[model samples]
Target: MDSNKNTAVISVIGKDRVGIIAGVATLLSQNDININDISQTILDGIFTMIMMVDLKDNVIENSDIVEKLNALGEELGVTITIQHTDLFDRMHRI
Candidate 1:
């Protein structure tokens, strides 16, 4: 765990099913990724979840998180994405 706090967003989309949140959360916990905030909902059987995570303590590279999530997405039949909050905020800034 590092001292400098870094932030990122993890987004998930998929057919509504069980264990989606649990699986993702478990992985983050295992990897020492801290969840700062989360929003999740299921609409018309489509599941969507967004997790804002703190990576300050995590030593794993962002690329590793992305790859693991991509593989997890395949296993769970979902689309998973991760992007730094700084870039996300910049892109959406008006």
Candidate 2:
């Protein structure tokens, strides 16, 4: 991962199912977003994931990604959200 690249946090939550990661990854790859780190787990029957992605090389606008992700989430029966790393940090800061 390139440390200097702009980054964003992507979160996915929904019922456990196949292809959640694959779907999200494929979309990101198509947009030139690079995954820097990922963590996922199943709590009971729910699936949750957090992905840190490098967006400096992305070819599309962030708003477009958000729209695409929202569509994908509907298709996959999951909720997907993205936020810039800085804003995410600030929102959660104590």
Candidate 3:
């Protein structure tokens, strides 16, 4: 198995609705990002997803990914955050 140390975490949170997965997955796929792991669920009609994506050798840069993801967020009415594994680990560590 591949290590997730270099992967990025993308979190999406918004009202439950259609096309959330499609929109996010499409952007990642278009950028050649590989989805290492994904988990999603609905809580009180709000949808939330955490995706671990591998972007080691993709055409898109980190800034570009942020821009694209922001665009998707705006379009979907969701709040999206993207973070590097190291930063995320540090921030979320117990």
What clash pairs does model 1 have? none
Error of 1 at 72 (Å): 0.9
Scored by lDDT, model 2 comes in at 0.87
Model 1, 52-79: lDDT tens digits are: 9997755446348888999999999999
Query: Backbone collision count in every prediction?
Result: 0, 0, 0
Candidate 2 minimal-lDDT segment of 10 residues: 54-63
Model 1 earns a TM-score of 0.84
**TM-score per candidate:** 0.84, 0.85, 0.83
lDDT of 3: 0.83
Give the whole-model CA lDDT for all candidates, comma-separated. 0.84, 0.87, 0.83
Candidate 3: stretches off by over 4 Å: 1-4, 58-62
Count steric clashes of candidate 2.
Answer: 0
Decreasing TM-score order of the candidates: 2, 1, 3
Q: Could you tell which candidate, 1 or 3, scores higher by TM-score?
A: 1
Cα RMSD of all models vs. native, in order, equals 3.6, 3.6, 3.5
Superposed by TM-score, candidate 2 places the C-alpha of residue 82 at a distance from the truth, in angstroms, of: 0.6
lDDT of 2 by residue, 1-94 (tens): 2234478889999997889999999999988889999999989889999999988756335349999999999999999998778776666775
